[model samples]
Target: MEMIFIFIIYFVIGLLASTLGAVAGLGGGIIIKPVLDLFGHFDLPTIGVLSAATVLAMATMSLVKFRKKGHKTDKVVSSILAVGSIFGGILGKVIFNIIAISLNMPTVTGFIQSATLALLLTLIFIYFIKKDKLTSFVFKNRLIILTIGFILGFLSAFLGIGGGPLNVTILILLFSMNAKNAAINSIYIIFFSQLSALILIALTTGFSSYDLSMLVYMIIGGIIGGFIGSSIVIKMSNTQVEKIFNISILVIIFVNIYNIVNLLY
Candidate 1:
């Protein structure tokens, strides 16, 4: 009964987080990691692994749904950014593992991740609110775009926050993309980043040791959320989507701040 209840909770968390995440192109790990961490239900590594798996599922389903809707994505931008994210994913995970091994203190890592995420989310919330007044830049340089993607991947992977708010923010402010295109490209980038992270994790820890039942519930929730979120976004205007995105970022910022405080003590 206890295990069943736990799974049910995770399923609900997955559903809500993925739904909001998909709407905002976050891929849900930003919410999952801190929420689960705050609950104290799983250790740090397990939470990170599960969060990655869940977000990967969400990203895959969301991208498929977008493609079916005839939403045109910039393949060149997506491919180049995704390739950069793959390499960044590897580097991020490598650094994370090193930190874990070096300090032998999981709480320290959690504190660092949560603190960084909180700071980033706060900044995102601020910039997003005032972005309309700012001039958006467009860079034709492939190297610059790839470098941006690498930074996105590194922060998201190392912090286990999926693609984070920076993906859409960078895409919009730097690449001059609108909200809709940025979201789609963000999901595409997250898919490859999470995939690379998962492959690295499999090579290291092996998924066999994790709880398969929990994985199923979380992934199922993510897929359902992906489908629903995609359908909802199709009907929403760019303004509506930006509203949702801003709201989600604000909520996540508070959650992460709480997690950071908890980790510190």
Candidate 2:
């Protein structure tokens, strides 16, 4: 009964995170990280792995939906990004291993809390400063997209965030793509980034035998949430959705920071 209850909770959280991720491209990590923190059993590294798993599932689902909708994603852009991301992911895994050895801590767990918080804050600051210009630029330049991909790939590997928001922002701000195109392309980028990162982690870190059941629950939740969130996006304005996403990310960042500080003391 207790296990069932916990499963239900995880499922719900997963659904909510994935839904937000699909709709606004910024919800999975922001939502799932906090909820897992509340459980007090998984710690940060476990949560990071779980979050990555969820993001992969969500991205895959989004890709399918985008394909059904006839969105034109630039395959060449995706390929370039994937190559850079794979190399970056290897570098990130090395950094993680070094941190683990030096600090005597599980690298993923030790860094996830602080990393997620930092990312959340950075994203919020960027969103506020460029609120009006959120959808301003269109990135027709393949070289520029490749550059953005390298940066995003590094960050995604380091943070386990799936790179949705980063991809979306670059597509809209730098590429001048519309929201739908940006959202679709972001899914493609995340798919590649996540795949590359997962491969690197598997090769370097060797997988941990955490609770597989929990991962399954999260994946199921993410898939359902993604579907619902995608449907919701069709009914809402881009500005409103983006604002909600930005505010939510800000709140999550502060909360995670507070928790990390508390843990320190």
Clashes of 2: 7
RMSD of each: 1.4, 3.1
Error of 2 at 188 (Å): 1.5
lDDT of 1 by residue, 1-265 (tens): 9888998999998898889878878788988988888898776777778898888888889988998999867889878888888888788887887786456778788888888888888888889889989999988789987887787788887898888577889889988998877887888888888888989988887876555557789989999988888778878888888998988888888888888777666
lDDT of 2 by residue, 48-163 (tens): 67887887788778767766766568677666766666666556655655565446575345446465656656775576567575556655566766666777776665555666
Candidate 1: how many backbone clashes? Answer: 0
Instruction: Name every residue pair that clashes in candidate 2.
Output: 45-108, 45-109, 137-176, 138-175, 138-176, 139-175, 139-176
Local distance difference test scores for all models: 0.84, 0.67
Assess every candidate by TM-score: 0.96, 0.83
Q: Which candidate has the highest lDDT of all?
A: 1
Best by TM-score: 1
Q: In terms of TM-score, how similar is model 1 to the real structure? A: 0.96
